[model samples]
Each structure stands twice: as C-alpha cells, then as structure tokens.
Target: MRTALTIAGSDSGGGAGIQADLKSFASVGVHGTSAITCVTAQNTRSVDSIFPIPVAEIRKQLRAVLGDFDVRAAKTGMLFSAEIVRTVAKELRGTSFPLVVDPVMVATVGARLEQDDFADALGDHLLGLAALATPNRFEAERLSGIRIDDVESMEAAARAILRLGPKAVLVKGGHTKGVLVDVLYDGRRMRRLRGRRYPKTLHGAGCTLAASTAAYLALGRPLLAAVESARRKVAAGFRQSYRAGHGVEIIDSHAVPD
Candidate 1:
C-alpha cells in the first residue's frame, strides 16, 4: 500500500490537524504516518492554547519516519515557529517526495497557530520545496500580500504565490462571499473549481483536502487529478459533516467515498 506522512499539530477535537489528516489518508487508501509538530488545546469552537514541540524532537520524528517508511508523499500543516519550519525544511531537503503544504496559519475559529516570523521561513524554505501549496483566502493574503476580494484578485494572489516556487497553488475561496470558487494555478494553466456555498461551516475541510491530495499523490496520481479527487473527497466529507460542537460542524473523513 502507498504511504503518506503528515507533519502537523494535534487537534484535541479530532476535527483538524494530525487527526483529520490521518483519517483523510485512510479514507483514500494510504497508510498514514505522522510527526506531530505541536499540540493544540482546542475543540470545534476555539483554540484555547497551543504547545509547540521542540525542534530536536520534531527532527527526530521526521528522521525516524523518513528513514524507515517508504513514504511516497507528505503534507505540512501547522509548523508553529520559525525554528520548526527551518527544522522541517532541513529534514525534507534532498528527498524527491511530493509535498502538499497546507499553510495553516489560523484555525477555523480565528486562532493564530504560528509565530509571525514563521511566515518568512515558510515562504523562503518550505514553499519552494512543495509540489503544491493550498492556502485559504486569509493565508493567501498573508503569504502573497494580495488582498483577494474577487476571482481576479484571487488569480493575482495565486500568481504571486506561485512565484515563491511552489509548482502549483490552490487559492481556496471558502471565505468568499457567495459561491465557493477555488483557483488553481500551476504557472502554466489555471483552473477554477466551483462548489455550492454550504449553509453550515465545517471544520477540518482544509486538512482533509490537503491530506487526501497527498494520499492520491502517494498512489502515483498526477497533480491535477490528485487535487480534483481530493476536492471531491472534501465535498463528500462536508456533506457528511455533523455538529460536533456548538460553533461549527466537523467533516467526517470516513464518509468520503472510495
């Protein structure tokens, strides 16, 4: 079976981060491995606190996994500090693995997940190594310094981010006003993926999307095909979402069809 790795934080709520990534990987027929970068005291409602793991420990975990497992692809979520980002980049260097970076800067409930300095490290070291980078509206604004108000601006932001060296960029439009439209730019072609705006917000949708994409890549699917499949999986999970807390629903990764 194919194997994929998630280098991310742990969500106590089991709705995002490593928990969601593992579930998404399993849903897509990939064996999941993980290197927890931090632990968040959070639920569907809010992130109360986050405790970042030491760089040494994070390095050890990455080394252990990359050394043993035949990891075909990997994804990064919440690297909480510049130190962690640099450490992860160092460890991942020289490997030919396809990386899916979900620039997880903030929680769904508006909690900050990383230090401001980490942004620079992410752009400088991590993004250049990524095969694909998935950033939401807010994250794209932060990463590209482009305020996205419409599809045109979103396209500009995707182009700006693509310049940072990621082979492809998916500017997620979930936070947009009306119909959701995710823009994908691979420096050559651009595609817009539109979906109905669900009445209820769902937690872990981004995590599930990125992880499922990594799983597909691990199975040897091409970039665009993997992203398309992952988007469908996320939509299915959204349809199967349930109210796990008082704030928002939680996507059910297990509900994604085979």
Candidate 2:
C-alpha cells in the first residue's frame, strides 16, 4: 500500500485536523502519518486554548517522517502562523512530491487560526509549489481575493486561485446555499462537481477533503482524479455525518472508503 503524510494541527475534539486526516487516509487504503503543528485543548463545543509547537520541532517531525517513510503524497493544513508557513515551505523544497495545501484560516468556533499575512505567503511562496489547493468558500475568498456568493462566483474564484500557480484548484462550494457545487479549474478549462446540500456544517470537512486528496494522490491518481475522488469521499462522509459536538454535525471519518 502507498503512504501519505498529514502535516497539520491536532484537534483535541477529534472532529478535524490531524485526527480527521489520518482517518480519511486509512479509509482510502493509504497508510497515514502526521506531524502536528499545533495542539488545541478543545472539545465538541469550542477551543479552550491553543499551544503551538516550536518551528524546530515541527521541522524535526517532518524530516523524521520523510526520512523514514516513502510518503507518496503530503497534505498540509492549519499551519497557524507566518513563521510556520515559511518554515513548511522551506522544508518542502526540492522534494518531488505531491503537496496539497488546505490553507486553513478560520475555526468552526469563530476563532481565526492563521496570520493575516498567511494568504499572501501562500499565494507567493507555497501555492505554486502545491500539486493542488482545496479551499472552501471563505478560505477561497481569502486566498483569491474574490468573494464567492454563488456557483458562478465559485468558478471565478477558482480561476483567480489557479493564477497563483497550483496545477489545479478545487474551490469547494460546501459553504454555499441551494447545493454543494464544487468547482475545479486548471487555467484552460473548468468542471463543476455538484452534490446535495447536507443539512449540517460538519467540523473538519476541509481537512478531510484535503487529506483525502492526498490519499488519492498517494495511490497514484492524477490531480483531477485526486480531486474527484476527494469530492466523492467528502460527500459520502457528509451523508454519514454524526452529531459529535454541540453546534454542527461532525463528519464521521469512518465514512472513509476502503
């Protein structure tokens, strides 16, 4: 079996972040490994406190995993500050690997998780280096500077983000109303992936999508194939979403496909 790595923060809530990523990877038949960037004292309701790991430790965990594991692909989520983003970019240099940058910024509990400059750094230094970028509506708006209010707006946002250099951009419309219609753009063409609107906003949906894409990439799918498979997996996860926390239904990573 192929192996994948998730470089992200840890959610003590077990609803998102590294926990969700690893579960999704396993569901897709990939061995999952992780290097945590932040640890939050959180539960189903809200985050109590956040403790960020040192940059040196984060780098060490990444290198140690890379040295020992033949990671077929890697996904990054929730690198919460400018320094960590720069550090992660520096560490990924010269590695011919498929990278998925989730560009996580906001928490479900209304706390901001990324620095104000992270989107700029991501566009300038990190995105071009990624095989793909998976940003939902709010994150897409932050990344592309194009506010997405509808399906047509999602297409425009994906195109704008593609200009930042990821070979493919999957702009998730999971945040929109009427339907969950995700848009994919590659500068030359566009594809719309639509699904029924699940009634709830599950925690960690973004992390699950990004990590599932990594799993598909690790399994040797091409970029578009990876995006497609990730979308299907997330949709099924939504259908199987459960009430784990207080506010929204949390995605059952057990919804992971085999």
The top-ranked prediction according to lDDT is: 1
Per-residue C-alpha lDDT of model 1 across residues 49-102, encoded as one tens digit per residue: 999999999999999999999999999999989899999999999999899999
- Clash count per candidate: 0, 0
- My TM-score estimates for the predictions, one after another, are 0.98, 0.95
User: What is the Cα-based TM-score of model 2?
Assistant: 0.95
**What tens-digit string does per-residue lDDT give for candidate 2 at 97-165?**
899999998887777788778788888888888888988889999887888889888999898888898
Instruction: Report the CA-based lDDT of candidate 1 relative to the real structure.
Output: 0.93
lDDT of 2: 0.87
Model 2 Cα shift for residue 146 (angstroms): 1.5
For all candidates in order, the CA lDDT equals 0.93, 0.87
List the candidate 1 regions with Cα displacement exceeding 4 Å: none
